[model samples]
Target: MGYDLERFVGYVNEGLLCCVCRDVLEDPLQAPCEHAFCSSCIHGWLVHHNTCPEDRLPLDITHLRPLFRYMRNDLARLQVRCVFRPQGCEVICALESVHRHEQQCDYALLNCSNAGCPVQVSRRSLEAHLCVCEYSSRVCSSGCGYTVLNTEEAQHNCVSELRAELDMLRAELDCKVEEVRHEMESRLDSQRRHMVQKESLLRSEVDELKGQLSRVMSDVRILLGAERARRQELERAELEKAELLELLKKEGLRPATPSEAAPPPAEVQRKLSPRSLALDCIKRKNREVTVI
Candidate 1:
């Protein structure tokens, strides 16, 4: 049953009340049996029983039709007090507008957010109550370590609080400074070790490269020496060839022609001699003169 119905019993008409909820019909519905009920109330009743509440007859939610016209007209004409009437809300509104007013009612009860605070006050007074509530916890505006109630907050000593905070902050700062120093030292040590390793590696690579360069230089020297020796040998061979050619020329030892090998006819050979050749030339001239 609705709590409003009990409170508004004398003011609400029986015809406008739902049989199931015993409250004024919010959204009235009429069954096929011509029996009217709040839509929610009839549906809830139908959950366990398939029969109408007024008459024991089989009924289904589908058989219900809206009575909006009659319910709205009746609800608009009915006047109701605020749901927070007992909580000092004196406002009265039409039944149709009651939900809207109650939704915004300042007199509505509000529970305290603090878990340790069990008191509830009207929404309008909640802020005032929180200001004085011992269970209400709030941060210190003076930058203190402790959260205190509003009532006790004014009694806090800013001088002592700041001193304690300074001490705590100084300790934290020291720890942070030491931590940062340690981190920096660790990083520097790591970097130094890395640099040392890199330097060692570079030195090893340089030594290896130097050895390679030395080997290359040695190979170049060997190749140059071998080239020089080969050139000297070639030059010596050319000189010897020239000397042999000179000796051959002085000795008149040349390749023999076919004529030299077979020796010319004796007559031709004799004519080749200086005196015989001159006599032949004279005789040839005399012969030519006689022929002429």
Candidate 2:
């Protein structure tokens, strides 16, 4: 196959391709003089005379080359076998396409699900592999360890904002609860004071009513006593008056009073006696009453 100049220059700059027999030269070797060549080319040149191609220095198998060799494949893998046989990539592609298959293969992986994640994925199927991958999600900026889903990037940002708002609400609620508690305590204290004042007023009113009731009872007792004494005096006076009228009726044949003494008719004057005249004199002076 013809060599591509651009690819050849790139391989050279990378120090991965051999200078001679340059078709991705395999089995690189080094001379004791610190010069390098392909293993086959080195062996052929050494058969003629044991000397380095770049420097005419005597060579031996024991020395490592001073120039750094671009490592192509491991020593144990030199035997002919499919590159991806162990990884379930059964396609037997050459070494060039090995790196390509490893990139585009379904089992091949480049990195974690998080695009900027720095971890390397050693396994396959990124979806199934990263499902349980701890490094697959972006960290929460809210200082929480909670991981955000890949499909919910926008939603997670929204939730982060809502978490800030929730903190504010909690603070406000605490303030309101304290305010309400203080208001209730104030109301309870006012009610207690009012109750004490009202109790004092009621007790005073009860005392005044008791005093009024005692005065009214005392006045009634005094009036009853006075009424009883007045009734007795009036009864005595009535009896005395009745007795005076009876005396007057018995002495009807004589003059009832001195004021009644007058010149009588000649016949009536002749019938009057001296004893009757003395009794009339006592009755006329209004001194004849005897209560005994």
Candidate 3:
């Protein structure tokens, strides 16, 4: 121990590796007894033992302080490996570029954060697997293949399959509804045709009945007119026959033959009286009714 500032300045560039993590000294700190340690290394050591390995002094994590900004910048300029390279990552970078490189490294090895799918996988392959992975799923509009979120690769909810099933069911229901509508339309058309046919038949029947009713009314009027005329004729014949019979009585002559007994009228030999004419018309109407 002799003071050597120039030598120490040259040696600062040379780094010490951590015994546990094997990374370069991240934030070099000192124990109370003057031994130096990487902050991370010391933190791990303190987790199990509160004393420093070299000095055996009591240690506390609260005593850790922020590294100098300039020192951090200098350390960042040093060479480092791709943090997850051993699993499949091929990229190596300076410590400064490690953050950005790790984010984009396709070959980086990744452990599935899902409690269910705990397989170790490459970052690029992890996304591909999640597309068909069973444990982690995401909502998909087109198909059941679950899409993985780049930002939240391991936190997708497994609902894509269910959503796909629901969509299928809705499609099936729609088909059924369309089928029912078609059937109803067919039935309605059939019923409408039947009603139209029935109405046509009823209209034809009504037409026939109207024609018969018209003929019957006309015949009834003609028969009634003829009966009236015939009755008047019969009345005149009865009056003539009465006058002839009175003449015979005045002359004191007895009518011996049937022709002399009742003088023949122009219409009939048995000329009717007024009351008899009306009775004969009634009897003819009754006989016609019986014939009908």
Candidate 4:
């Protein structure tokens, strides 16, 4: 919306008046056709019609631009009264400075600072109103560290409020403690599972080693038995050799040479009588024992 023309201290240029609101242009924007209007007025106008409000020329929001620099300078130099003038503010300032003046103006209306307050008072009276406003808040004098509204001060129960706060804190602490306990239990369960798995793996390895050791022991035992048998055979052969040598010495028989020990011809053996064959077998046994 444009500023009210009556608020100005002196004459405002006709060109500075918004074509839509017919008031002094506020945040003026210019169309491509060189027509100026308040930013708000033009936007609202364009919402219903896409043409310029004044000349009805083909126009759009995209065709709007800030006011020309010369027009803006002239607009800023125009003197204007405070917006709170009806509330006793008599300050007159350049249009550019009017906003700054109104912000700090004592006549400016402000809502009551207390929550749920419905009263609106001038800045100069707000402090006095706060002193007596029933909706105003104040710290509890009961040492409960709570702020209570003035209207509810008489009914406020400091002890009950404090007890409720304490209960809430206790519940929160218990929840935290329960969470920590659960976390610890979960961790312990995970560790226990890991330990059981590791123990099983170790036991399996030990069992495997034991199986290998048993197999190796069986093989060693078999080898030892075979070695023992071989040694016993050699011992028996030696004993037999000793016995044969003693028999030969007692009978005054001499050991035969290798050539004399050779078997008789196959034809001769075939023709031998049973008695001769028996004597030949005895001599062969004696030679085998001598060789051992």
45-135, model 1: which lDDT tens digit per residue?
9999999998888998899997657665876668777889899998877776788988889999989877678899999999998877888
TM-score, ranked from best to worst: 4, 1, 2, 3
Choose the strongest candidate by TM-score: 4
What's the number of clashes in each of the models?
A: 0, 0, 0, 0
TM-score of model 4 vs. true structure: 0.58
Candidate with better lDDT, 2 vs 3: 3
Per-residue lDDT of 56 in model 4: 91
Clashes of 1: 0
Quantify how close model 3 is to the true structure by its C-alpha RMSD in Å.
Answer: 22.8
Index of the highest-lDDT prediction: 4
lDDT at position 1, candidate 2: 18
In candidate 4, what are the lDDT values of residues 57-92, reduced to their tens digit? 999899999999999999999999999988888899
- Local distance difference test scores for all models: 0.75, 0.57, 0.62, 0.87
lDDT of model 1 at residue 240?
Answer: 50
Each prediction's TM-score versus the true structure: 0.52, 0.34, 0.33, 0.58
Model 2: ten consecutive residues of lowest lDDT = 1-10
Candidate 1: where are CA atoms >4 Å away? 1-81, 86-92, 103-106, 110-119, 123-156, 251-292
Deviating ranges (above 4 Å) for candidate 3: 1-15, 18-23, 32-34, 44-51, 55-73, 110-120, 131-292
lDDT of 3 by residue, 1-292 (tens): 1111221112334324333344455566655554446776777788998776665777677665555566667666666666565566656556667779888788767777665676777877987777655566444544546665444555545575567778999999999999999999999999999999999999999999999999999999999999999998787767765754564344344324334333334564364556466544544454344334
Question: Candidate 1 — which pairs collide?
Answer: none
The true-versus-predicted C-alpha distance at residue 208 of model 3, in Å, is: 99
Model 3 lDDT at residue 219: 100
All-Cα superposition RMSD per candidate: 12.9, 29.9, 22.8, 8.7
User: Candidate 3 local accuracy as lDDT?
Assistant: 0.62
